[model samples]
Target chain A: MDLTFTDAEDGFRAEARSWLEANVPAKPLPSGDTAEGFARHLDWERSLFEARWSVVSWPERYGGRDASLWEWLVFEEEYSRVGAPQRVTQNGIFLLAPTVFEFGTPEQQDRILPRMAAAEDLWCQGWSEPDAGSDLAGIKSRAVRDEAAGGWRVTGQKTWTTRGAFCTHLFGLFRTDPDAERHRGMSYLLIPLKAEGVTVRGVGRLDGDEGFAEVFFEDVFVPDADVLGGVNEGWGVAMATTSSERGLTLRSPGRFTAACDRLVDLCHRQGAVASDPRLRDDVAQAWMDAEAYRLFTLRDITDMVEGRSLGARSSLNKVWWSELDVRLHEAALELLGPLAELDGDAPAAIDGGAWMKGYQFSLSGPIYAGTNEIQRNVIAERLLGLPRK
Target chain B: MRFAFTDDQLLFRDTVRDLLDKECQPEHVRFAWVDGDGRLPQLWQSLGEMGVLGVQAPDAHGGLGLSELDLVLLLEETGRAGLPDPIVETAAVAVPLLAEVAPPELQAAWLPGLVGGGSLVTTQLGGPLVACADTADLVLAVRAEQVVAVPRAALRLERQPSVDGSRRLFRVDWQDDDAVVLAAGSVAADSRDRAHDRGAVATAAQLLGLGARMLDMTVDYVQERRQFGVPIGSFQAVKHHLADAMLQLEFARPVVYAAAWALATGDPDASRAASHAKAAASDAARFVGRQALQCHGAIGYTVEYDLHLYLKRAWALSATWGDAAFHRRRVAEFVLGPPDLPDRPSRSEEIHHG
Candidate 1:
């Protein structure tokens, strides 16, 4: 029933808060999807790496501080509270690293993690393709065994590869056994985008950033060492990735709480607290929703510490926080009124149109990492024992 | 950092849950709807014997001195069973406030009887309406920053027909001379405020259980009932609705637990936490109730079916302390400062929108 953090955790929070307060960029960096911004974010990422705060929850062998989960959460809260730059290295550090830790070979972990921690190697996910967006098992990517070469020859096109133009490598599912079941036959592979036959075409996102891309591979040679989990076992391994993606790894409650605080500030600045009761209430509701998510994560982390499995409950978390993110941003935009539509460059745009940009970004939350519709199906079938159609 | 109940707390909850499962089934609830008092005395006595009624009362008052955190889960069990009693009004709100702010003479007169289940107690903390006032031996009412304890004999009770037949609602009329003032001034105001929070959080926990029960009933029903030559549960639309319902309940559950913890620890944010809990739980339960009925279709609309019992109870309790909108306003005040306008719309107008 205890809710207070341990003194050590409080100390960890204080330390992280001080470090972030001092080091975070005074002005926000440009979106990392642009080349110049990508380079700028890399410096920030390296600064975090230098402080050993980049992967606080990872093992010290991989350049992390080997912090506990509670400490990691504390660090995240502090990081968000200080309004630090978005983690440009998140695709690798948060999403792929957890999978790599769980399913990567010792040699692979030794080779991959430190570089990821240092942001020397940028990784993007290649899960969704032109035909395999929500129905990910409908992946058409193939990898033929090149036994003579001691590897596989991969040929595929992966679309909606986030930050693909900027990333050096990609991790995706490729069919290795065509004859197996729909969920079977796939292999999780880590492919270098710099490889000879690989091509990347940046796709414009709603925010007008080249954050999305279509990656094409023409018989790119990948060594057997690059396969994660195992051949024909990619479905299971990728499930682990999706769970972490939907769960605490990619989106922690800290991000939303920070946004909520900003939303409250926006309301106060606009005098909406006195002018519009309904909008003020919306701001408060958003704040409370954020707090609820924070409390939810505490219970969730408690369960993890107690050795309980999250199972399909991660879907619940996904549906909640994603929608909350959208609502928080929407409230900010409501306060901005018609000026919400202005670009960051516009003089009249409030907060450099950060709320507008954020609202656009939040639109993707329900669509990516498995659509909310699909997550709902998973929740009903797996979590609530509903029958499959 | 351990945001979970201890083994002892869970054990106590499990005991009450098992007792409710055995003795307070839907049939017992149905019986209460037709019964004059809308109560099951035997079940109430069983809860008293299990120390469920006296969970927050002092040890000297024939009770188990436990915190709200220990009793909250049990309260959820009561809601799940739709136990058709004013346990939230009595055990959770009235008894605790009485134990805290009642004078020695007042405490001696009522605490033992209330704790021992020899007397029934109901309170009016939110509005003019009082629940189960007809059956309660004592009615604790908040009046102008004073907490007055009145014997049922001294009050005139006008029954107000409610959606949930298992609950007896009334508008009570009483004279100041007939009631004893338990506490006055700032102490009374503080205790009254705490009681409101307690009532809200307790109702939030109950709504969680009631929503859970409705969802379960709908899930079970959908699996058995068929449509278009297939089980209705197999329909993606039906499943999605149920999934959304489950999502609401799941997120709201943690909020309720945290609110209970905040109250138990007397956290400075207890008022806001309680309001947050009530708002979240009320919204979740109301949403789940709608979806549950939608998923069940015609069968759910009937009184013979079990879903309506929980659904009705959830609807009643959602508005019990202060409906979702009221609590949300409180949270709004906690986050954004109090509204500056004096000519704001009345509570009824706001409730209409809510």
Candidate 2:
């Protein structure tokens, strides 16, 4: 197997690296989880949009360079390396855009993707209700026909709506048939978050920011123009979103590799901690894990290119990166010693408690998308041919 | 770039796997372990005839000239079948080592025998004991960065039995200077270092195979062995355990193959790559082994059953070239810079000797 990049890929990397070096903001943006910070993050995304750097993997019509998967990976590495601000539009561009591209009509793509590229239409995922988390098919949210209101009216509660507090729209699964049981008659609908009957209450993450929210919908009207795929085929359509969540789109190896490097830098700054053998081994393990994740991501890309359905392997990727994320941050925090516990502004806080912030965020990884426990069940039953319960 | 194996390599792996399935059954393994010196002479001859023995030996030595990447699948399949042989040593390691660094006369005396399937060669490259030193015609020993070709008859042997009974290891008492010096100085050091890297990668690949085998066995066991009222695999805890094992094996696998490829391509980071592979594979092996045994409940611990075979082999090979801790220290040195902790000297020596 060839791990080396071709000359063309190398050239693309060089171009991406140079552009990112020049274009990244001179100062760090505010935390994207905060209200004001979210706006600041949007401005940066707008800059990227003008320069066609917001979504390089998308086609030219969606304000992208039409880059290949490998080039997108390279771009991610280059973008994150400069300590660039996080992508506030990732929910729309990375997670939901693929479903739109694959399942939505040409008109829907033209209407939604361009605004998403320009960061004018940030999106939040509407999975994981208070009751229906890992068992996504148990969703109780309903979207009944409202002929008088001119379309479907959605009534439900969507918890853990990542970026829901400040987002303009949401793409969620709504049960459309009263007679159909679980996993049937489900419709995938894209609704405006500011519709008349919608309410979004911010839910605080470990970092004490309203990074996600509990979105309440009471007769929120959604036109028929925005329903994705077929009425009862939402399970199949949403399965693609699950793949996007677990695979390259959500947790790219570039982000972790960059974290590993940052972790090593922190260790070296610790002097004595860097020299401790146990901590050194932990550092080595972190690097090894990140490198392994990188190679595994490459294998995933190759498999997709070869026309093999991702199938159960996406669950494998989810388990891997989520654990690695937790481990790498844990190692970094452990190396930081007593300073690790301090908040960002405390005098004793090390690196502004970035590691602590990251540690908290990392803890959510295995729980969100799908719990690692559930992912393991998928691996056992589907991949290992274990009998279904 | 393609990260998966080529069609040809997949076909080769299948052929090796099919052969082992037919010839290396548990009874044959038990028979070799209980009744003989544990060397499958006939299988060894067959491998040599297939050029598996000389895959890396130079063209002049009547070899296949294949690199570590080609031999890794063969070694993996061997590990899966729990094959009791040192073809990995004789073919994958010794022939290549001798061809690269053996003294001219030593090469003349052994290389032809090696490629022609008439002779078996065991190896001891900085490991504590020699594997199959008693059964092989020659033992390639390394000391002070020098490669020596020692005749099995030249030394007194004390049998050092491994936890895995099929392995026949020995503590050989011989004069280092009395043996044939294949090469000395920096050239010898380079050649021996190369061999050690290849050996470590080969061992890591084998451990991965062992892990995969145990995972398969445990998944099957959990399905067939009922508990409460249904197959235990249907239980959440059991499924989670097997899934975790499968994840470890999957993660370790790409690392193992990438290390093999790095060694084949002579990447400057080949040493670090092999260490990464070894360390990861070691964890995967132990994790899979533990979970497999636990999942088997009562039937797993008994030697009378098949689970013990792969479990014991997993334990045996994880410590062969370099164990998890050993390779982790090496990797630490590579990635974290030189260790400057209080135990720096001891850690340095541990890395240096291995």
Candidate 3:
């Protein structure tokens, strides 16, 4: 359909552009791989939240303007266009708040929604145990009833818990009935990171960044009120949560566009590799892919505004876009050449080896939420009416 | 602000779909394509009577005054039907240009016959290159800075077989005494470019139709063909490949339609949109054609099977005006900067013999 925005939407874009031009910090925020750097990024996020610019799609009652999806997309494009700091509270604003608003009780919403909006309580997902990843129904994390304590005791481990070390709250799934069917007996819960017996151990990636962690929940007590949706219905709630994560987070084409822009700028500035036709072709293809992805995302948003739910189609976008991101960063690494092997402490490192770091980070994209293999299966069976293999 | 077709447009699409289903069945297309002299006279006359040929032509030119969006809808349905006709060429390309550049007397003389299908006309026959010197009642020929209108009868026409059996190419010999040169200088150059741009959009529309037909044919074939006691379509690899094909088709559909919409609305960014759409459609057709043939195996390559015909059309249509690389380079230029031009001799002394 039509990809161009309306005049009113254009006005919104103009206003957003002006505001970002006036307010974006002169110094770029440090990339959020190290502890201190991530903390500083969180501070910048808090400042944005204070200015009520953190969640463009949330309701006005929840400290947002209740803007149209087009406006929200415009905000994202404008924000990323100006190289604003990455939203440190994305797990809170994009993931948790939407789920809580839909499934959380009134009191639960009151408790979590405002803090998430204000970035007062940072959040991280507690999915993906060491053994259970694509098959989340096979999770072994358990939360047994404690009659005397008037709550449940969660005792298990969660690996690949992104930003687990720094977050104040963890939203997760736990086995409420060990004897029930794998997907039938789980319960969604929110546990404070500082709860008694909770421990977070950082997992250093190849980039030597502690962005991921393994969290051990040792008899951590979570009140019944912390349960998201009905008990034993965590599978459904997790579906909703994971759908939002994959759809909203992975399909943000503006992110890739911004990355492509930076890569192009870097290529232009270096000038050494611009002579390679293969590299140039790769860059051009990446740019085209990003543009197509952005147009597709715009089409989806338009459908939503017209009251169409994309349902499983969102998985198609998620898989396609994540692979595109990998392609882009891989091209960046090739552009950087042998310098990509050098890391943070090297004297001649390129942009602190951000390209190498991005390459490593991109490796996790097709693995997290749902692997690309699983996404293909979804597209085949659900979208294409293929028989089960 | 609405991004969707209106009720009338929806009805128009439905009518076109219904007509194609009845008149342009695969069997009919295959029969006419194989037996006739590349022209389906009876079917063409019927369509003309049904007002399909004039769907987008101005009423003043003895045709219905419809938008380019309506024309796209008809093209998509024609694509779905695997229709073999030259309605797209005569209506979309020839008539529109004639209305724009022809003298008022010439417009009054030829447009009515062209729209009514009383006078059959086809585009210039060349290998992915445009030369409107043959089959056209009046050739819109551009030489250097001048655009000339030459009578087709005055030019010698030599037919050449092409990969796309549905269309025939011709070599034209134009005598220096039989041309009516129109505008010259920069105006001619700009008009020619604009005409090429419009031709690109129309060709992309045709490819879109071919792509959709190929997709449907492949899907149907896979659904019926059995291997090891199962429909081959049930296989994961086959299903995934077809799904990917569908994705390309659907994505390209919107881009094509968007360009048509821009052209219809006379948007300032029409050329850019048209190029984007053409590039996307060309890639989609090539991709879908390859996969469709692959899915059909040996039979798809056989002459008896109709899949090869559609694939041939797809290949030929994609290369027309410009291929994917050309359009992509145009996009790159737009994004980068204007390209350097080569100097050429001026056409100031060129004469109009007519």
* lDDT at position A140, candidate 3: 97
DockQ values of all predictions: 0.78, 0.79, 0.29
Residue clash pairs of candidate 1: none
Name the candidate that leads on lDDT: 1
Per-residue lDDT of candidate 1, residues A1-389 (tens digit): 88899999999999999899899999999989887899999999999999999999999989999899899999998899988988889989989999999999999999999999999999999998889999999999999999999999999899999999999999999999999998999999999999989999998898899899999999999999999998989999999999999998789889999899888888878874445778877888889888988988998899999999988888888989999999999888888888889999999888888999999999999999999999999998998898887
Residue-level lDDT for A35 in candidate 3: 81
Report residue A296 deviation for candidate 1 (angstroms): 1.1
> What TM-score does chain A of each model score against the native chain A?
0.99, 0.98, 0.94
DockQ top scorer? 2
Candidate 1 lDDT = 0.90
Off by over 4 Å in 1: B345-354
TM-score of each: 0.98, 0.98, 0.90
Instruction: Tell me each candidate's RMSD, in Å, in order.
Output: 1.9, 1.6, 4.0
Docking class of 3: acceptable
Tens digits of per-residue lDDT, candidate 2, B226-341, equal 87899999998888889999999999989999998999899999999998998899899999999999999988989989888888889988887778888888888787787675
